[model samples]
Target: MDLFSLKGKRALVTGGTHGLGMAMAEGLAVAGAELIITGTTPTKMDDALSYYKRKGFKAYGYLFDVTNEKVAKENISKITKEIGEIHILVNNAGIIKRELAITMPVEDFRRVIEVDLVGPFIMSQLVAKQMIDRKEGKIINICSMMSELGRNSVSAYAAAKGGLKMLTQNLATEWAKYNIQVNGIGPGYFATSQTEPIRVDGHPFNEFIINRTPAARWGNPEDLAGAAVFLASKASDFVNGQVIYVDGGILATIGKPSNED
Candidate 1:
């Protein structure tokens, strides 16, 4: 139980303002880690901070574009200076542009890669430097189901996430000796605002997801908290370079035919 306590630790979560990122960050906070939230949107930052305050967790917010190496470096340095050393970092900030591969603009593809893949690399490298010096840290990359499976109209996203999966392994291989554990969390179709309209009963996508998953349901955001906390805590000190798929058993089996059940 003590292995899971994050007291005396500071966590920096990129894109901690909303969605799955916010969910994981809140989990760490609940485990006793002070949060350093980073986002590009002021409104979201404000709202998130207010929510966290209401929940009685210590948290700070920063604004930055994670894809910008210089800006990320600056913000990391500033946060280290202002908040204290960041003992944990969650590379959760990302963007996805869904479009047919044949027609997807190169620039759009590049942007998705930049945000989803390159951004994690930059953030991890910057944070890992300090973690290396301290000889201890935790880094979590928010990966996706697309890291292993492909879907229509998401070529860029799949590419970025796939690359991110590999990045997680490579980073873990390099940094494990330094006592910094790097891992990833791959989430499945979830009941989020972005998916609300598509999640209603009888919606084609919703129906597909319910049937596709072995657990017969879309994942709840809360489903991710336990995994996030485990990977961020000392409980996982010996665990590195793995991507825990918190996907309602979606990745574990071949799907039953839609007509069978």
Candidate 2:
């Protein structure tokens, strides 16, 4: 349990104002990490800060576009000056455009790539420089099932995530010697507000997810907390460049036939 403690550690989570990012950030806070959350929305940031404070966690918020390397660099510097040096970085900021590859605009595809893949790259580079100097750090990229399998209407997303998986491994290999661990968390279908509509009874997509997952249910946002904590703490010091899938066994097997038990 001591190995899992993150006391006195500063964790910077990009896009952490809501959804799964918030869930993971909360997990880190519960394990004693000081939170430095980043997001693009002011209202969301305020709400998240209030929530964290209400829960008695030390938290700070910064707003910025992570994909813009220049702005991100400035903000990272500002954060270090005002808050503290970052010991853990969760590259969870990303975007997806649900359009068919055939019909998707090149700009939209590029935008998705910029945010989902390049944003992590930018954030990691800036943060890892500090970690390299200190000789220790943790980096967790939020990946997805698309990182492994192809899905309809998500061509750009799959491409970016697949690239991210490789990037995780590559970064881990390079930084392992410096005692910096780079890992990824690939989530499965989850019961988020974004998915609430499709998660209701008898919805085709909801039923599909329920039947598809070996665990027989969609993942709860909280289901991600433990993995996030592990990857950010001393518990995973030796774990590097790996993507831990939290998709309820969705990737462990081919989907069962709709008629099969």
Candidate 3:
């Protein structure tokens, strides 16, 4: 059991105030790591920080935008200088805009790409430099089921995620000898604020997901906990450049609606 522990580790997660990022933060916290979660809003960060502090968990929050390379570098550097080096990083900040390619504005597409793809690249590069000097670290990128397959009106999101998958591999290839493990989590549809609109529209989406997935259900955020902990802990010392999908068997299926349940 202790083999999966992250005791004495310090972790940083971007966009960690809500949804999968928040879930990942909690998972790391429960695994005994001190957590620093970043977001753009002070209120949300404060709320998350307050909750963890009240729970007697070691947690903090910073208002920073990962898309801003200058701020990302400055704040992260400040954090390491003040609190100690962050041994783990979860690149979980991202955005999506749904529109047909023909009608999609180039600016909107670029916005998604900037936040989703470019932001992670910069964050990983900056953090990997620190990790390289230390010769040990864990970096987890939050990819999406889109990394494997695309859906309608989300070409930019798919493209960004797909790029992230390869980026994870590339980073692992270059940094493995330095003792850094770079991996990604490609999540399927999970119940979160970001997905609440679709979930509330109910039947069509639920039916589609249940029939599509062999597991016959939508995933919850908690479903990703063990994977995050494993990748962050010493247990994954040999794991690198991998994208683990937590999609309730959605990715494993073909065209058939497997109603095994």
TM-score of each: 0.98, 0.99, 0.96
Comparison by lDDT, 1 against 2, better one: 2
TM-score, prediction 1: 0.98
- Candidate 1 clash total? 0
Q: What tens-digit string does per-residue lDDT give for candidate 1 at 120-171?
A: 9999999999999999999999999999999999999999999999999999
Per-residue lDDT of 241 in model 3 = 100
Q: For candidate 3, what is the total of clashing residue pairs?
A: 0
Q: Order the candidates by lDDT, highest first — what do you get? A: 2, 1, 3
> Residue by residue across 121-218, what tens digits does model 2's lDDT show?
99999999999999999999999999999999999999999999999999999999999999999999988889998988999999899999999999
Which one is best on lDDT?
A: 2
Which pairs clash in model 2?
none
lDDT of 3 by residue, 41-69 (tens): 88888888988788688987888889899
- Alpha-carbon RMSD, each predicted model: 0.8, 0.6, 1.5
Show pairs that collide, candidate 1.
none
- The 0-to-1 C-alpha lDDT of every candidate, in the order given, reads 0.94, 0.96, 0.90
